[model samples]
Target: MNKLLLTLGFVLIPLLVIFALFMTNSVETQITLMCVALVTAIIIGFKAEAFKYDYTTFLFFLYLASFLGILCLIQFLFHVL
Candidate 1:
């Protein structure tokens, strides 16, 4: 359960943040997400350490890759229509 929560924490938080950003009409979406990313990184880092996990940096980037891959897939599907 701990691992699952950690995984979801690292994955969903940023996506949720970005989704929130999309709801706004701000012209600085990139900057907003960047700030959200930094805050979420701190949160994930601290939580991972609290659970005595290792290879945090590796896992972060791996999660990021998976997230981006999903985003690309979604974009491709949209464009294919």
Candidate 2:
């Protein structure tokens, strides 16, 4: 169902990023997965748009990317410190 896919898309992005971080010890891999998750979430949200000028889709991507970025930055800082 569309709703399920939409929900999965919402959930999987962060999950994948975390998984990438845990599975790979490389910052590059984590960043790559974060970007991939952001793009995939954007595409999925766009496709699942059920309303005009759906701002929720934009917010979803924004929040996801921001969260991922913050997580990666924290990890990097900890690594450097």
Candidate 3:
């Protein structure tokens, strides 16, 4: 169960996010952005673990916020520029 959650945390969640972004724009740029954010979250979560911090729950929230923030920023930028 732990391994499954970790895999979902590190892999499936990001894949779903990227899939959603692709569905939204069907553009390479949006896909790339989502992939980058996913990678960033994975790196951060791993780092927190390496440092022996109790970060699993917090990492999930952080990843979700970061994902939403990036999407919002992309939409805002597209509208503004």
Candidate 4:
């Protein structure tokens, strides 16, 4: 179940981004959806250790999530004020 959810999360991340881009016109809504997906990915990455995944891979995911999260914050700020 964990592996399945992890796999589904990875798949859904991109799908959520695409959906946010094409389906939503509001910048805030798009950013909100993206942040939600990124947070989910981060959670799954943290859980990967139980499945014996590599530490380096988890760090990489963490790095990517942080970077994207920062970008989302900036975008939100710009969109808002």
* Most TM-score-accurate candidate: 2
- Stretches > 4 Å off in candidate 3: 25-53, 56-60, 79-81
- Higher TM-score: candidate 1 or 4? 4
After TM-score superposition, what is the CA distance of residue 51 in candidate 2 from its true location, in Å?
6.6
For model 3, the local distance difference test gives 0.61
Clash numbers, per candidate: 0, 0, 0, 0
- lDDT string, candidate 1, 8-77, tens digits: 7667666755774465444355345545665665576566663354665656656765665565455446
Determine the C-alpha RMSD for candidate 1 after optimal superposition of all C-alphas: 6.3
Tens-digit lDDT string for candidate 2 (8-79): 887987688778889888888878888888788777776777233767767757876788889889978877
lDDT of 3 by residue, 1-81 (tens): 545545556675567666656556644555556666666656655654532556566666666777667776786577568
Give the per-residue lDDT of model 4 (tens digit) for 19-62.
87678878788878888887787777566543365667667667
Worst 10-residue lDDT window for candidate 3 reads 44-53
Candidate topping lDDT: 2
Residue 30 CA displacement from its true place in model 3, Å? 10
lDDT (CA) per prediction: 0.58, 0.78, 0.61, 0.74
TM-scores for every candidate against the unseen true structure: 0.41, 0.79, 0.45, 0.64
